[model samples]
Target: MPNIQFFALAESVCKKLNLPPIPFPVRKGRDEIIFNPQGVALDLLLDELEQYLIEKPEEKIFYKDAFSRLAAIEGIRLGEEGFHDHAAHYFELGLALDPANLALRSNYALSLQSAGRKEEAMRQYRFLLQQPVISGQCLVLIPAARLFLDCGDPVTAHQIVKHCASFMPVDNEFWDLFAEARQRCGIKRWMAPRQKQQEIMRQATAPDYKSAPTGKKKNFCPACGNRLKPGARFCGGCGHAL
Candidate 1:
């Protein structure tokens, strides 16, 4: 109904994995295929594909797109099942085959974050931000801002959202994070019209700001904004180890 190509592929995968074929019932209309989410054993198929990829790494370049799709699906399934580390592993494998796949990259970064691998998550987000297509996507911007805020970089979070504002209307989530960033950066939102107007005027008339004095910079957790105790190897707030 809805393109039975993957169905055949799934059957082949089952054979390769030495598993029984999925008994997909024959349906009358295309709508049945569209509505049935569990019509296939996607997770099992993906597991088989992962094993196949592992044993036949040379075939990855030839079957990159298929492998990437399977990996993405499996990663999402594992993440939904509360297996974040496994999810991250699959996502990483997917990204390795198709580095330009932003969706896979986003999912992988999210999995890394969920798995308490904050530094690695930040690195992936930063890499995504540098990509022209990804930099403009709100999906990437929102999470990157959140990560930056959590990592004690509200200034960076604010800057990222502010840049996004020029291209797209800010959503509620963006505004919420923006408010948090402002608060954390020692700024307050004005409720009064007069105060708001005065603040705007001040900003318009203020002289150019000078750089702060150079000193030893404080270290903060990449996972949470808690100040890192000297020589500490983990985040106290989120339990993310360095």
Candidate 2:
């Protein structure tokens, strides 16, 4: 996966060290639209970042900020062209930066959803909604709602939309989605329920007739009601070897 945003932590460290800013989602052999952070500068920054982490374990905010920025870059990449590599990398950074940050977690969930990792993304959303801090912000709420809808869990989607009801206006996209959410919620009820499939029994023996005194008689296997031989070691009609 090619991430468009390079490590902002690395970029920040390099900038402080008076090095060139390396952008992310490195496109090899193409014109460097973003900064590249692979050579000596990258090495130095990585070493420094590790050392910094060791030296000051309390600077959680700084690390979190770096990750949040990286996640934002991922969201941008998703909007631009729905690139999973860039999206997933940024999401990892965001979660790594601040695991407690529901916003970051939510964003990462959306990234995973866009990347076709529905269950993983749904897990993240469920975790995020469990937190007492979840609110109706579009960035967080919209994607969460979308994920629920996509998962055939429209009930949850409706709850999310209703929770954000105050935030919606007449022309807002949420209003349309709210309606969709309702429709999705009731979709199963309106549609005819699917019938259960019964197992088909295979024939144990082929059809055969027996010559009885009064009339022709038939002996069939109980499993498939197929014809069978009387007192034979095997069923010649259907090859049911006794």
Candidate 3:
């Protein structure tokens, strides 16, 4: 999809990088803007767009836009380099300029989490949850829930997942997290009260044969749901560890 926000971001990035702007056909009526992605790849375009913005004497509105884009780009790069505090600084500046930028907000929240600023990250995630445009997005919802869980607020995480259930797909990872949240939050009502009581009675009365003793419970990778081998530190499928 051609995201208008990202299109403007690309233009702003080009300005900050002092690179020639992508050519667009000039429209006479209603200023219709068209973009073609056949020639240059988006990643390559963004790679060329990375730079720090320097203010000039005769700065215009475009300069501020470029500054915000540059800040966002640099913030992401710095965050990847493990300089999360510095990344957050740039993300804050970018968000101050364009408060409605969802991508920048997401990056800001991630930077805060990476910097061990848990409360700040949660605050940003709450703000994002209130935004209609971002609330239903998986990118925002998944991380927000994970952050809530990390903050020892599994109830909030479960609530977030419940609110987004209709729109979000039922993924194994989400279900795994939901199960953990429910367990941690002490939510035992998985069925009707009468049915739960009946099931409990059935289990109590059922004759059980002791099976062979099982060893330690198996662990699965949270990212990919692959069965973790004994003593393995990382997931074989996705490379993420528990």
Q: Report the number of the highest-lDDT candidate.
A: 1
Error of 1 at 204 (Å): 24
| Residue 178 lDDT in candidate 2 | 76
Ranking by TM-score: 1, 3, 2
Residues 111-190, model 2: lDDT tens digits: 78878888988888888888877764557777788778877888999899778877644444666677788887775322
Q: Write the per-residue lDDT of candidate 1 for residues 139-202, one digit (tens) a residue.
A: 7787888988999888888878778767645365666676677788878762333445788999
Candidates 1 and 3 compared: the better one by TM-score is 1
TM-score, every prediction: 0.58, 0.48, 0.53
- Which pairs, if any, clash in model 2? 3-25, 4-24, 4-25, 5-24, 5-25, 6-24, 23-35
Point out the worst 10-residue segment of candidate 2 by lDDT. 191-200
Whichever of 2 and 3 has more lDDT, that candidate is 3
Question: What shift in Å separates residue 143 of candidate 2 from its native position after superposition?
Answer: 2.2
Model 2, position 239, has a per-residue lDDT of 64
TM-score of candidate 1 against the unseen true structure: 0.58
Off by over 4 Å in 1: 1-7, 10-40, 167-170, 186-242
What lDDT would each prediction earn against the true structure?
0.73, 0.60, 0.68
Model 3 per-residue lDDT tens digits across residues 117-157 = 99999999998888888766876787788889978999899
